[model samples]
Target: MPVIAVLVLDGVPGHQLTAPGLAFGTAARHHPPVAYDVRICTAPGFEATGGLASFRVETPWGLDGLADLDDTDTVLLPGHERFRDPPPPDVVAALRAAAARGCRIGAVGTGTFTLAATGLLDGRRAATSRRNTAELARLHPRIDVDPEGSVVADGPFHSAAGVLGGIDLCLDLITLDHGMAVAIETERQLFLQLHDPTTPATTCAAYTPPGSSLAPTTTWMEANLRHPLTLDDIAAHAGLGARHLTRRFHAETGLTPLQYLLRARIQRAQWLLERTEDPVERIAALTGLGTPANLRRHFQRQTGTTPTTYRTAFRTFVTNLTPRE
Candidate 1:
């Protein structure tokens, strides 16, 4: 069991307070007793957002609760009203001590400000709410602030952009703790619970929507995943130089054209593996990976399992869905 301490100040962000419990709880229940020790530890300072402000907040834990954490544990900081101000000396020391004990530190939205003040984020890439990105950069010059990403994880520290991004971070942590299958189910359950039945659930792909300059190019890549694509080919299709294409593609999708193409190919392979009776060799060629060995290598690298294993798990998942639910 992994222990997670959600350290909330007065104005705790709703996402920080809820997402961990939701994501981890779903994992715990769906996986048959992978107990998670999640607790809300209250401390002084901060203001509440959303409907939480209307009521008095109370929790049995405090900052002292973080003392028991080890490397496998996580300490989460939620954005509060006073997050913009520097963290108090005791708070900073406590965070530092937790880090020294190998506990991972995570922050959501403005909570990153408190993490940054502790100097733990120095020389690390971090992310925060888009609206506050520039200020985060200016205040913590040593921290490399990424405005484009919804979440950034460097070493043992992780930071997310907003409420939704915080949930994504938690899902990522679940994946790290268990595996991709558990994480995907957790994500699917969350989507099912949060969205209307009429809405379709989306996959966890590095998918980019339209409106970017690279939209047409991405669409073309998806349609032509069977072809072995090169940088020059993608650049020509986009009517740009290779250098310009890489820069623009990365700006829009946070991935190079080739990287995006490979992921798209793998995603296609996943769909084929789940829905069709295609052999590994056939699926490999269909996805432009050329050989079964090649497909297995990249598939394992991205998904943490072989193609056969993934298909087996998917089958088991479908079979067990009714009883588990």
Candidate 2:
């Protein structure tokens, strides 16, 4: 069983605390036995409160309760407002010790601010709410704060943007460590959509058309995922040289044009795999990925499952659903 310690702070978002709890909390139900033990730890004088209704929560343990931080495999820091100020000396020491012992550390929203203050995020890829990006960057210039993605996982540390992104981060962890079936079931139990990290619009405003020469080229590739087009063709269609297109493409999307095109095609394949009854080879063809074997490789690489396994699980999920038919 994976033991998860969710470090709670006053004013922590209730949903952020509950998201990972619900996902990992239900692990036992997944394999017919519980696979995780989750605990909420707080500092002394800890009085947790949240919700529009505003309720107070009581915990039995204090920071000393996390004396076992060294033994914990994963530590979760949920969204909290007070993370701007460095954590108390004792808390910082505990966090530093946990990392030195090689525990996977995770932070959600401004909770990242707390983790950053521990000096553990230096040279690490991390993320926080857009509202706090400037502050995080200004405060910890050594930490790479990714403003675009909801979550950034650099080796042993993972950080997320906000409350909802917290859920996505947990799901990603479950999917990575356990399996996609566990992740999907957890999402179903929590009444949250199964998130795809590449679908940026769900958690972020769509990046506007930057009016670069690569703009129309990307737009065309997004629409033409079913067809194979060479990079030279894309450059010509965009009315730019290949070198110029590559430069502008990377600037606007933070991905080389080829990389962006591959991501778009893979996302399309995931959509079809989840929503349609198409055969794997057919889905591959439609997504411009060419072969079922190739599609399976990429699907597992991106989402931790093969096409057949995903479809089988999806079929089981549909069977369990109440039929509108």
Predicted candidate 1 versus true structure: per-residue lDDT over 106-158, tens digit per residue? 99888899999999999999988778899999999999999874778899999
lDDT of candidate 2 over 205-312, digit per residue (tens): 112132445555666787798888788878888888889988887777667777777777776775576678889989999988899888877777765667766656
TM-score of 1: 0.61
Error of 2 at 222 (Å): 26
Give me the candidate number with maximum TM-score.
1
Where does candidate 1 clash, by residue pair? Answer: 11-46, 11-47, 11-48, 47-81
Error of 1 at 275 (Å): 17
For candidate 2, the 10 contiguous residues with the lowest summed lDDT are 199-208
Query: Against the hidden reference, what TM-scores do the models get?
Result: 0.61, 0.59
Estimate every model's Cα lDDT from 0 to 1. 0.77, 0.71
Provide the lDDT at 132 for model 2: 84
Give the local distance difference test score of model 1. 0.77
